[model samples]
Target: MKKTLSLVAILAAGTSQAAGFQVDTHSARATGAGGAATAWLEDSSSIYYNVANMVGVKKLDITLGDTGILPSITFQRPNMEAEGQRTTLSPPPHLFVVYKPFEKAAFGVGVFTPYGARSRWEEGFSGRFRGYESSLATYYINPSFAYELHPRFRFGAGLDIARATIELTRGLDFVNSEGSVHLGGADWGSGFNIGVQAKLLDNLDMGLHYRSAIDIAFQGQADFQNIPVEFQSRLTDQKAHADVVLPSTVTAGLAYRPLNNLLLAFDASWVDWSTFSELAIRFENPSIDNPLPKRWRAKWKYSLGGEYGVTDALQVRLGFTYDPSPSPNNTLTPDLPDANRFKVSVGAGYQFKPFRADLGYQFVALADKESTAPGMPGTYSGNAHVLGLTLGFNLQ
Candidate 1:
């Protein structure tokens, strides 16, 4: 069981749908606006969006937020009347704090889960050869600083310390038998983020942000359970090692306020998922080393969102987003099933004295995808619900 869990983690890390499972929903306000915050951020959560905007924050502020992802994934194969498999949900949480003791300089610290999710398939499912169960998670601890270059422009940078964990389980080829392998590991890596924000006009602002890629080397032990008598000795109690790269991304956005009580924002983002070209696992036994191909390509996403001030202390929000898949048909497996998708969201915010709170919800629908891979023929469909909450407090 231990080995099955560990192996599942490494393999599952390679299969993600949201910008390659990068987790774009960080702040409830930004999520409610369909992830268009770049220049429209006002709370300390700006630490995760555009670091340059940190200088625009008011006094000292801190925010705590969480996003829950509930996904329903199903698969159907040729000539099979059996029911589809369903997946489990994973939650991502975040915390951020920002302070500006000087007129032109600001600093912040944050802890957040930027990438993670899990998938599980039914026993004896048609796609058992590809994957049975897996889970992957990543967390980042960031320390950031920003400077107001001028009255209208700001620049910022941050250091990212990241930690990742994985567990995976999959079936093995055996005659009329139930045999599986488990793998698990954990590691830490480093990366960086940079951004620039400018007030283009009195009521218009523009921003650009970039997050660098992180490489992690996961080392752990693998266990072969219920293996046939012939394969048991060679596969059990072996050491495992895998090197993986988390992709990089760039985003640009604009925020415009035509009326004092209304704000609009739009964003375009590009992710370089080609970095995740393959997954190679090396065992203590050199003869067992193998590589898994992952020919993912770069992809783009667009979002638009709006907020209206309904009263002095209340605001309403709405947003929409379009995300295209990067995985190709030939390499598409049940483990990492994916396709183009759309997201619609709604949220509201209210302020009570020195504290402000916001809640947002999003509905995700993925386009159906079919595969004709030689012996593996199947169709995958999925939908998800995302809910986010953010709480902010002003100390100064």
Candidate 2:
């Protein structure tokens, strides 16, 4: 029973749609710019990237956006190869509103998906016992306020209310017979974020933002099927609980305008993945209690993006990012075959009076990873295509 229940740890340590499963597609403008708009205060998305920038809002601004992610992954071992079977698109949405009631103060709210991922493997795959299908979704609702302290400096803080859901399916080993187990759960958590934005020079701006970690207590059920009659009594369905701590992050960015028509931005982020060193699960049946070690390490991500005004109402953008995986090779598993990633993106935006629209596309490529973890030994390779669209309106 312990062996069979060990696989459940993957539910909390699953594959990430983005770097370690953190989603950065809050706005099409930022996405097209490779997510480097931390200091480029041009849209309401500032409520997510750097709330301090909200002080720049002239009056009232609202932005709505969505991103679709399509992934293709493959795993190979010796003479056998299996293709990931997930075919559906994962779409995460974002909405932000900023209102400036006075010259020095602004209020804003944002709703977005900051972390989520989905993975599916073909039937009869060698790693089915590890994890066949899994999905995780997290939502963050933030309400923030910003104030201009100095003429060129602004500071802000926000409260983060988060909700998360998880579901997973894995095959159960019975030697000669095949069985399966499914787990599902939901939980709520809270955290906080603070940011500072400063205008260093007429053409340069700097911003720093920090988000605290959140702890979620999940309570759910585990259902088992096809258990042999001999072991049915021991492996029956039961309740389960787990404690998971989401990582915190600190990001710094600079936006520079070298040319009157061109704006360039760069950002660096440090993720405290070390906080997820282990996961402890307590089942209704004490016999199945499990503690899994993750040993994930902290990592850094870098992004560079540029936008050029093609005309008074049209703009073109391009961006690039390098994100390293936090999961170490020793503990890597089939459920989340994490690896370093490189991304390239391009987009365009148009402004029409009180309405604006932006479209962006990005391609993510993961470096092939060779894993020798216990029963699953293979080389995993994958890539994803992401497309995003955003619409904005200004009410004065």
Candidate 3:
């Protein structure tokens, strides 16, 4: 029972909590700085970022977007310390649709990868001494509706269905004469999202959206070969039944045209990271230690960003955000090296009448976190770079 509870807390929050953990400035207008404006989602993207903004559309617009994320990590466990890391490539894509079927009613739909990333420590990597590899993938399908009530008033709603899978390999410190085992599992879940956007005034806009929490139950088994005994409690063990929680959040933004061609936007948001404070999974086939410790806590995230139009055909954006690590300093694990961060981003777009294209780039510099946990060890002093592109076509 102690082992099961311990294992659950070790992997829950970092793996399942939905605390806006990603610093994705995917929109050209949102990335230029770091997504400071929530009101700009008026475009087709309102489906993922803000459904209330869906009413900001005047015609039928469809958008296709993609972003590539590359990150590096380091570790300083109670014993040894390693630094400066490089990870493989993970690409995420998005698609959005908005149409004013009638004058007062608008329909929207979008497909995108909301929260995701991949972390792989190559063979011989230092962390391998503890447990060495992890990768996660996830996506969502969003369908929504919006209606314009008055000249500057609009209302909207959204529905989201998400799916995910993962492949991982961790090292097990051995004690006795037992070989270490490799552990892994895959699961899926479903959930819903609701939102509202209203023009607080002519130059100020307000938006709020929430994604209901979900539970993904893993069903796959694992393969264990050369394992270690000391770390066998966590690594060599296999889980037949386990469940993870995906929380929810709310976002708000404003857009103001400070100049004739210059549009300024800023956004503020919050997430429910506390739902993951802990987790305990009871395997259908109970093991010695069935329920483990999924110790995670509530976290908070906020962002500020804006966009400017250089000309009728070109526009630029910039944003910044602060993300707090939900994993406490005491229980920090290698499966997820999460911590607070200060993000900087830049992006631009080109508009051609009914055709528009956007591109954005971001850099994440870690805020110093010198945590010397027991199992995982490392001084994480690295950064991450992200590239995003979006294309939009209006079916007028």
| Candidate achieving the largest lDDT | 2
Give candidate 2 regions above 4 Å deviation: 1-9, 12-15
Q: What are the per-residue Cα lDDT tens digits for candidate 2 across 226-325?
A: 9999988888899987777777999999999999999999999998877666545577888866565567788999999999999999999999999998
The global C-alpha lDDT for each of the candidates, from Candidate 1 onward, is 0.80, 0.83, 0.62
For each candidate in turn, the TM-score is 0.94, 0.95, 0.86
**What's model 3's lDDT at 75?**
56
- Steric overlap count per candidate: 16, 1, 45
lDDT of 1 by residue, 1-396 (tens): 001112322455223436457788888888888999988695678878899999877789999988888877777777875334555667789999999999999999989887787877776777776677878888999999999999999999999999988887878778778788787888999999999999999999999999998888888778888888887778777888877777788999999999999999999999887765654567888787766565778898999999999998999999999988777777666666777778998999999969999999998887777866556667766778899998989866
Q: Candidate order by TM-score, highest to lowest?
A: 2, 1, 3
Predicted structure 2: lDDT: 0.83
Error of 1 at 389 (Å): 1.0
How displaced is residue 117 in candidate 1, in Å? 0.5
Q: Model 3, stretches more than 4 Å misplaced?
A: 1-26, 77-81, 84-86, 125-130, 176-184, 227-239, 279-285, 288-294, 375-378
